[model samples]
Target: MKFSKAEIDAVIAASPRTNLPLSKLVLSEERQVRPQGSTPKLSVAELAASIKDSGVLQNLIVVKGARGLYEVCAGGRRLEALTVLAQADDIPENYPVPVLIVPTDKALIASLAENVFHIPMHPADEYAAFARLIGAGKSVEDVAAAFGVTPLVVKRRMKLAAVSPRLMAQFREGQIGLDCLMVLASCDDHVRQEQVWNGMPSWNRRPAYLGQLLTQGEIESDTDPVARYVTLKAYEKAGGTLRRDLFSDDDKKAYLLDTALLESLATAKLQKKAQQIAAQGWKWVEVRARYVFEEFVKFGELRKTRRAPSGEEAAAIASLQSRLETLRARMDALQDHEGDDDNDDREFLKLDAEGEPLEAQLKALQESLCVWPPELMTQAGCVVFVGSKGTAEVKCGLVRPDDRNGVAEVARKASEVDGDGESLVSLPSAKTRPVHSEKLTRRLTAHRVAAVQAELTVRPDVALVALTAQLAHSIFRDDARGYHRPETVFAITAADCQSDLPTAAEDLQARILDVVTEAVDANAASPLAALKKADAANGAEQTVAATGWLPACLRTRREAGMATEETLQDAPERAASEALAA
Candidate 1:
């Protein structure tokens, strides 16, 4: 019996399964169900490994072709892998591949059925499956090898599977997203994870803030200077616990749970540094984990006098500089030759490695020459504090206020002997510039705005003229360039004012109604529409320039005791309003 491609039900339902020699299988043209020029879904090597680990679990669909060969219409990728294994001698040349035989006319339909009808497993289900395999005592590496994925992938899936069951159910139900799920998985405390998830409102459950909530009490090793100084390796050696973030691409990023231990280590290191600085004959040396500006501001600072380098030191500096220069020249040359060439890259890296230590050694030699005089060291003190980059920093030549005068007196006495006196050395002075920072200037301007608002509230005349000028500028100015900005802070959003009753006084309302009624009557009664209306329009236009006339809304609100016409005439904005009218 023959079957056509359109007969999917018959072809898929009753296809006979058989084994065919790997050598007799050929890929058919209709097997390309994926889009043209698209990358293959699975790596051929990975597929071959999977097939080698566990023989083909899914049978390929094929049709009998010319020359007694079976043409693979579906599972072409598997056929490719099998062919590769056979060519590599990993599998026998005549190895039998399991396949389902369908009619030649049903080839395309069979291919479509295999490719189109295949549904991928959900991520949550995959994570659970991996967990089950681990529970079944399969190693992560073994599972990765069997699945053609890296061990990291398997471990990540296992971590996701470790999330709270309630949260995972939410994830499966689409209540929680994969990103938030991964964040919750960062912490292994299932109870804490559930508490955080349940405590947060839907709107506030972002991944970043969720991570912050989870690590609220923990110190970040990546940012905390003390952690950087003590180093994660040392902290671990000291038996401190670290909470690693699996979601973080950087494995080195973690949270130090024991902050007290971190501080203790940092303090001990700083103390050891302080002891070395004290041995230089300073009266006192204090060690602080962090630098506090307010605590050190009370003491006077001394400047360092740089002495010339010694003969041996100068020669060493020269040698290091020469070596560094040579390394830099080599690095620059290697950079131009950098590309697919691995040798040039290795040479560049080697030069860089050689240059860094030489540069550091040269800098240390230069800085060591700048020393506090022995006369000044006895009068001043030293402070060893941790700098922002987590390096130990020393602040020397800090004389107390009482000690400052005593040192000045000693210098005065010494000046009497030699008659050439040394000036009291002071800390570096700031370059002359704007005294107020941008932030402070903004704050001061804000206070001035408040003050101006208070005074402006009582001055209605000034407010009216200002508002009139502002509106006039907006309406009549040429500001297409967008350079003009309204000076007033007021937001003027216009809306239609609807009312059942007239807003003006009753007498004023009656007069306006009479005038409008008269104009309508005249226009209707006259044989020719009256030229009187044009005369009125001319007079109104003239009135604008003649009397500086403004609409009542545009007119300034006068103070109770103030004379309106005189003040309006004298106002600069009123003049501007007149010019606009003209």
Candidate 2:
């Protein structure tokens, strides 16, 4: 490759620097107007907000225009932002805007050089810098303010920074995706992260699946039954840990890391309830953290009758009910607690204390109202268990099949006749399925998807290409070839790789392409290799072999992309050429 003397002359043209009022700077007429799906320009409002947050950190390149005015050749967004402030009177018309004044003839060169021949900062570097700032005693808010970003943005960077270095390397090498990295960052266990990655076949490593694998045993704090059963306060008191995702729009996006501890706390509460039930002359009381209706199918339940409390007990119950009503009124008046957790907790505790005696007395009276047959009681016992969401439930009068007696059978028959009519076991349905004829589609796709996902995860090399592609496409599509494109697809831009590359050492893209080529070249035993080999139409195509990672679907659409079309008067090069030559 060679550069013309004109380009060298443009390079050598020295640009002088100067400062001017914001109002005096204007957009350059010479600024190249690119079509959509080409170079993307920053919107005025967005640049204005950024400028308002952090004053211009870099200078715009400008050239002398008509009437002694300066036209911005580069940093058009910065110029536009300053113009907006000037229009709104947020800043004085004479407010200083840094500018690098270049020769009028060289203005286009300056703009071209700035827009082209440039690379974006690596995401890893950005994350590390943010982490460093926080590590240096700057609070997240402080760091956000310093960088002109939101606090949540700063936190996201911190999370990204927290990702395992090993995983991040895979990302740089196109082995994993940015979304996957983000999910992995949510879990701090590096060893666990790598293990999950390794366990996943190359086809199934999607961000969602990766998140599932990373957070498998963990529970969502908002939805976990245990979280609801034991108040967050109690769980925290018991040394359970919670992780919150600041990046998430939802305020309740907190996850419980210690599921074991949550179950332990729930068990302890159930154990106390079980102790009280044991005193009721039951043969045995089984306590479990959770209960499933199906597990008790073989255990027959006994019926119990309820009896009214004594006069004195009735009076006490009436008093407790009145107290509870008043408390409930106070709770309603508070209108959703509205950040008053302490008051809510205190009121709940008070209600619990007041209800305890009433509950016990009521239970005793209920037992007196009904009695199981003596013969049935002798053979059967009850199981005490915690229900979903952490409430204690009793399955009383359970008679094991082994303990069933002739008298118990008669009683069971009578109860069945009076019970709600529902089958104890489920039956299979004989309905036809949809046109789709498949099974475990999800599991099967994972193996095909993992490699693609890993390969297209974010990277610094094709960042601009991705950005340009995104902006060039409609707003409805993902920016350029990012996120949505199959990992095996390469949306290569010819405009890239145009640096002062006297050698490949300075060309990052060259080295990366080389790595990809070698890696795919060595994977001769890949799953798709056989399919590509059998494709007579494109089997000899380079793209099919180059993307050994891509499954058949992603590898080709029509003819192989790498196949060369027949061209010359082919001493039979093409069919037409062959006919003509003959």
Candidate 3:
């Protein structure tokens, strides 16, 4: 088992030999560029030129496979580049290249170690190389140390490499900065990644702007990635601006107080108007009933029809009466002559005269009956009656045996009032009876009022106005802490004082007033304590804890607010609360 150094060297030299052509040996194998693999050991242009001018830079390393074949351990690109050069007439047609034969396992290990340790590559390239090593079963610590970086850095780089190739290209081209790319890499959704990518402008100029646009677009876009990207680009081209007007401390305080008072007045007015309308409805019903009754009385007297006969009928009746009178006169003269004769003759004459009288009476009766009977007039009474007088009297108490005189008097009154002799009467009656029970009426009224109040409270426009007012008041109160003035606060109550109030007049006023009161009360306390309390009340805890409020995020940003009491109070706690709520 033991051997001297000379013996060992002699054994290694005499171990094995191969007759494989160097060209075949180099061309037969393929090598993988590491995952964290750099751009290349050489640039594509440099390698192409080198191959065209001379040949492959270094011998291709290979491992012996089954039979007489070989597998590439490293230097795959060099071989390919040389082959390409040969085919293009840039290199010799049958070029011979160097080769290094090694064991398969050792060749693979060598390829990984060389990629992991030797080059200074981009993070993406390094990550790819590390991944290749790990894929080949290398440990993370080994890979980290080999690259002279921390394990965390190694992991992060690997993650960066794992991002879509399209994103990595964006990074290299500077269409998106490293921070933005890191954010994109952290996200798991492909749609979001694509959105961020497509939202970016071309990398030639304003890369940071493109990144910002992409971030904003992602925030505003809906679930669809393509749609979001398209919308963001369109919005930018359409000239969108994200601008805010910051108020001074004094201005904010004045706004809050005025808003609160205005809102209270508006609410009170609305309640009063609702009450008035309800009262008006009740008054309208009573007035309408009285008017109806008066109208019926004025028009009731004209409803009877006339009973006079036509001229022709009257003339015919008169002629018949004249004929009958003449006949009666002739019969009387004949009867006087017959009385001078025999008793039988006298009796006969008398009978004739009597019969003539009967004829005259019949003719007179016919004359009297010429016109149709007059229609009976309708009468107004407590109860309207239909049927025979006796039946009507019994059912409706129109008349009783003891009150016969009263019935006669009513009949007389009816006949005088109605020109025709009609007995029908219509009396005024209450149209609306008192049927609304006290409890039910009260409940209904209460419900109606409540509904009105609820409707006012829940109107979206109103709510929006209120929220705006409240926000303005909050801003104002914070600004006006120690030097608060009632007039300044009340200024917001005026029509044009607080410009930030929501456009909806009523609700905005109400909400603004409420916020003003709250702000004033808060400001009245110890300024620092009030701010702390406000911050706590505003749900700043979560935001502060997360360190992700907009104020905190922008505190060190280029466009931070000017130093002031309000800005100072907007530290982690307050800013967080506001951001989370927002």
How far is 210's C-alpha from truth in model 1 (Å)?
3.5
Error of 1 at 527 (Å): 95
Q: Which pairs clash (backbone N, Cα, C closer than 3 Å) in model 2?
A: 37-472, 203-446, 203-447, 203-448, 203-450, 204-446, 469-480, 470-479, 470-480, 570-573
Q: How many backbone collisions does model 1 have?
A: 0
Model 3 alpha-carbon miss at residue 126, Å: 13
lDDT tens digits, residue span 229-254, model 2 = 76677888988898876555687667
lDDT by residue (1-582, candidate 1, tens digit) is 444556777777788988989999988876556543343656777788789889998999888889898888788888888988898898998998999998877677778877766898888998999999999999999999887788888899999999999999999899999999999999999999998998999999999989989999898988988889889998999999998887799978989999888888888888988989999999789877788888887787766656789999999999999998888887888777736888888878888987888999999999999877667678788888878898999998887766767766654564566464555455334346543446544544444334335544776665666577667655654434333333322222211111121212211222332333343444432332243544444433332233333223323433444233334333444433333222
Candidate 1 vs 2: which has more lDDT: 1
Cα lDDT for residue 56, candidate 2 = 87
| Candidates' C-alpha lDDT | 0.72, 0.61, 0.44
Best by lDDT: 1
Please give the TM-score that candidate 1 achieves against the real structure. Answer: 0.59
Best by TM-score: 1
In candidate 2, stretches whose alpha carbon ends up further than 4 angstroms from where it belongs are 1-13, 29-54, 66-68, 83-91, 231-233, 245-249, 267-287, 292-298, 303-396, 400-582
